[model samples]
Target: MKKKYLIIGAGPTGLGAAHRLRELGADDLLVLERHGHAGGLSASFKDDKGFTWDIGGHVVFSHYEYFDALLDSLLGDERLEHQRESWVRSCSTWLPYPFQNNIRHLPPQARWECVEGLLPGNRPEAAPADFGQWIEGVFGTGIAKYFMNPYNFKVWATPLELMQFGWIGERVSVVDLRRVLRNIILERDDVSWGPNNTFKFPLHGGTGEIFRRLAARLDGFIEYGQEVAAIDASARTVTTKAGLTVEYETLLNTAPLDILASRWLADRDQTMVEAADRLTHNSVYVAGVGLDIQREAERNPRCWMYFPEQDSPFYRVTNFHNYSPNNVARPGRQLAFMCETSYSAHKPEKLDELMDQTIAGLVNTSLLDAARAADVLTRWETAVDYGYPVPCLERDGALKAIQPRLEALGIFSRGRFGGWKYEVGNMDHSVMQGVEWADRMISGTPETTYRWE
Candidate 1:
């Protein structure tokens, strides 16, 4: 082997970098994956019935043309595109997705109150410093209290007030008061406003399969099940969990930077380990339910919905079977996918109790019916300890405090957790990070998405 570029964690990021290197006719690339597969937490599995589901919901919505082109080249025509009809289920009603901005669905009393808060005459003459303040700036206090604030705390596992509003980009909705009021008076849903209105999903395998296929294509370059245990920056060498060492000119790590930092610290002493402890990530428990519903995937083409009310342990539910017919067993087949949830530490719910409660909540919410149901087929979990990178008030301070010093030591950390910018850290962003890293390393191209883009 040519002792080439060492790519850690064969997730989307690593695989993307390797594939890009090969596509560019570059050589001496080695990808080390911790798990036995290409996809990390974004991996997928099949039930005995051959139904495919991602570790969690991994929808494909990219900002880069390269990402879309890469995916199309992989899956080709066997892809499914869906228009998301998402809404917030609260106050015993289904408010449209831009819930705060679309308060026309709310009852008369609530609507008038929201209007007074947001209506042009009473606009606040200030800028928002926190997520809560941003909500008030965008939707006003009345609407913020009703959905934006609590729903955010439930989803992000951090209080809105504790988070800086800088990360909020196209991820949120800022309503035009006049347009909102006009649409509301006309009894319009206006749900088709966001960037995810039309999104693409894999037709056969789960979202993870895209990376799996990418790995298979780059067979000679990637080594699965090879976990990176340590990195010696002085000599530019990487040691695997299994004691195998490889020397590289430059390394791109897709593993959590904190984890990689810990391993690098372990190669030294306790002082570095103490500093590494400041990095925080939320653990997520995803419960995948396989149910026996009568409706075919076509009838319920609706992808997923959010339930922020007190009745459900799951903050969000993906109609997995509906997302892709291949996600569940066919009509005569045995296993049919039901729902999937992302449970974080903020609203920690017991797995057993929460699952049962979730099923009951499904019945109550007219999702899973009591009368027509098959025995609960499968209930397995995919727990990710480093799911969400908490955007705490101190996150920027902590990163600036630690990351630059690490970077100074010849460590180029970049990935979902590596860069710690959730706004762009989806599969696409992760891949782009790797691409940019490799490009910068090889050709000295501008790596915009690494820190800023």
Candidate 2:
């Protein structure tokens, strides 16, 4: 088979590209998806018990107008808007999200420690070199010790020193001594600091509904269950594991860049393999625990909570039922908890025992009652091999070496893992990367979201 454009992995990026290509009057494009379904990491599932759950904690918030417009067009009135009520669990108490800003909620001793560390010259004077140092320099020893250090390690599953600080743009809420003190003195709840303060959710299905509706617009263009096996870049051809080969004038890869470079490419060299080796990522295990709401105290207004302490194996847990009433079988009468635990070589976890560990964690963190363990209606879980694309010290340098070389061969890699950029790997950014790539391909418009430099 031959096509003008070929895209691998029909996730947000591939679907977005196909949608835009068609909109721009280009029909000679095809998207290859390994799974029989679409949505990639954003996909949702319904257990036999009728509870819907996403892969992890995914909230629909955008940094792009085009992405917002696309979502508006796709879901229309089928979506629900939500005010983010996020919190942090530390010192066996719940504090507002961005723990540093709400140190007042902590016990007097812990709160004073946070403030004392932020005083005049307690923090490091020199410019920080890594994420670990940056956390200390910016948040001070107290905040880092209480929240940032442990929470980040649990989420990233990587040593903070090995990771770089460039990726912490809007993702982290950076606070200073004055801001910290003022919030405490003024007794203010500084919860509305981030871009996802107000977000949207699908009223019926989980977060995947947005992508599912988008994929439907480009029906015949996407070929499901066709995982790419090898790509001869020089020949501009791709071979799938199902023994089908397709030649293309141009290719867009929405899969992991490391795998594309090290495992897929037929003519890859030493530099490409070495560059690929430097691109590190952490795997995630998402456990969805659901049960009937037995008591009034079982419901909470908070959307999600972070676990910085070792009491919970999971770093984050989303009150999935709060996002949409339709998430559970009985709506307001049921509860759905989606917990995420990340693991990597730096922080190994017993995947086999994580579900049980997660349940125990929920109880330990006070989300679940110890006696209600037997009442769980469903325990749905999935382990994703490529969860977060780690912003390692060598990531930028590796991308600089690999991306340009691939682009020279009429191949473009974009999206979350494809671009290997955690900073712009959100759903909106991933889709726009593909849309921009399509624009660049068809009309010579420059791509902006995932710049290797």
Q: Can you give the TM-score per candidate against the true fold? A: 0.91, 0.99
Best candidate (score: lDDT): 2
Q: Looking at model 2, how many pairs of residues clash?
A: 0
Model 2 score (lDDT): 0.93
- Residues 270-311, model 2: lDDT tens digits: 899999999999999999999999899999999999999999
- For model 2, the stretches where C-alpha displacement exceeds 4 angstroms are none
Instruction: Give the per-residue lDDT digits (tens) of candidate 1, residues 206-299.
Output: 8887888888988877776777767787777888877788888767777886777676543544444554566666666676767555555324
Quickly count the clashes in candidate 1.
0
- In terms of lDDT, the poorest run of 10 residues in model 1 is 331-340
RMSD of 2: 0.8
Candidate 1 Cα misplacement greater than 4 A, ranges: 120-124, 266-276, 295-299, 331-346, 372-374
TM-score between candidate 2 and the true structure: 0.99
